[model samples]
Target: MMKKFGFTLAEVLITLGIVGVIAAMTIPTFVTNSQNKANAAKLASTISNIENAFGIMMVQEGANTLDETEFYQYLTNKDLEKAESTFGEYLKLQGNGTVTNFYGEDKPFKYIGYSAVPENITLSESIDVYQTKNGALLMFADGFNEITEDVAKKYGISVTKQYFLLRIDVNGKENPNIIGRDVFVFALCEDGALYPFGGKTSSVIQTGNPTSRHYKNSSGSYACIDGKFSAGCTARLIENNFVVDY
Candidate 1:
């Protein structure tokens, strides 16, 4: 007759310990990768929604260009209420179309390292916030500046007119609402295109190329600095095929 086939207590413990070690080594990495993928997807969808809303609004308003739309004028004039309301109408917002000031008392966004806040992002200025039906919060700021002659020469792009600035929270009011994480910044260019903030230019959007020249993927002002707020991280993420490697 065969003896007891099962391993002794020591052998069983050893095997279990090996399995535990393997799991411990891999679980956190797996979880992080999964979260990164989810964030990337959410960001992609948000971008598409915002762009589509603008396109639809332009069509309905009988406007051939974004400058012809009321939203553009409102933004130019820094009229938060009208700009936010127009966006709400175009996007078919679920709640009351209200544009709230998310400035002054407390800011909704946080740095990558909340406790050790960095100066990469400035929240002292006023910003207009609107929550979309999809749970993404759009923060609008009249932060655009004309691409100076020096900047044009450096990037080699002919873009002169600066457009709107958008700080978006892909997960709405969820935890870890930090820039370069759930929050991202973009430049809504006069060309009716959105480019990752800190990017060299909007040529990446205009050309439909992921690997474009002078486009800040993971470098320059928009680089994804560890434990710091980097608004241009959005462009870096997009250039890296939505992979949140950082």
Candidate 2:
């Protein structure tokens, strides 16, 4: 027989063990990467759908200032009426005025398809259409109306207050400047100016919390919109198709 180039049993076992160890370490990483990529694709697709609907609505209505309800209504009423669409089917607005689909649940307009699910999204809360005293809208969670009196007192704002231009910054903390008040509004001006209305500025604004900003402070990472922290800003903007100037 040709001098066997193949390794002996012991040597082969050792090599196999090493290969197994490497594979064990890399498989989870690969899976995680794959999941992230899939989620990204889904998000992009959803955003495109939403933007397309918005574009249609704008063309028909001759305006770009539609509320969350109006946007959904446009999709379900007009877009779906004309074209059989996936997003319209996925977003089954309920009789109680809530919307549901593959995503968990949403409180109207605060967040639409913003949560992270393997295949769907959940709405974070309802949108606050009011403005704050400082001219910034109280942009945060949608369940603001459900906050307890003590919690409201702690934040120095009421549950009925609304915020505009909400930003869960890189630190994952809600900007204190936008907390509390009614009628929050952040206008993305034609000149590319971001203006916040309502709420007062405090000298010591807390920053960095995963709940609000969705990033660990020690990591020095920035807040990600829609629970995706690793993607670029342009990708996010393009996906959402909404102006997130924060």
Point to the candidate with the largest lDDT: 1
Per-prediction count of colliding residue pairs? 0, 33
lDDT on C-alpha atoms for all candidate structures: 0.67, 0.31
TM-score of 1: 0.74
Q: Write the per-residue lDDT of candidate 2 for residues 1-246, one digit (tens) a residue.
A: 677576789999999999999999999877755544443343344333434554554456555343333433433243433222322332322111212321133422221124333333233334222122222222222211123445445655322222123322111112211111111222222111222221111100112111232222223222233433322232233334433332
lDDT of 2: 0.31
lDDT of 1: 0.67
Q: Which residue runs does candidate 2 get wrong by more than 4 Å?
A: 1-5, 68-246
Q: Estimate each model's TM-score.
A: 0.74, 0.37
Best candidate (score: TM-score): 1
Q: Please report the TM-score between candidate 2 and the true structure.
A: 0.37
List the lowest-lDDT window of 10 residues for candidate 2. Answer: 197-206
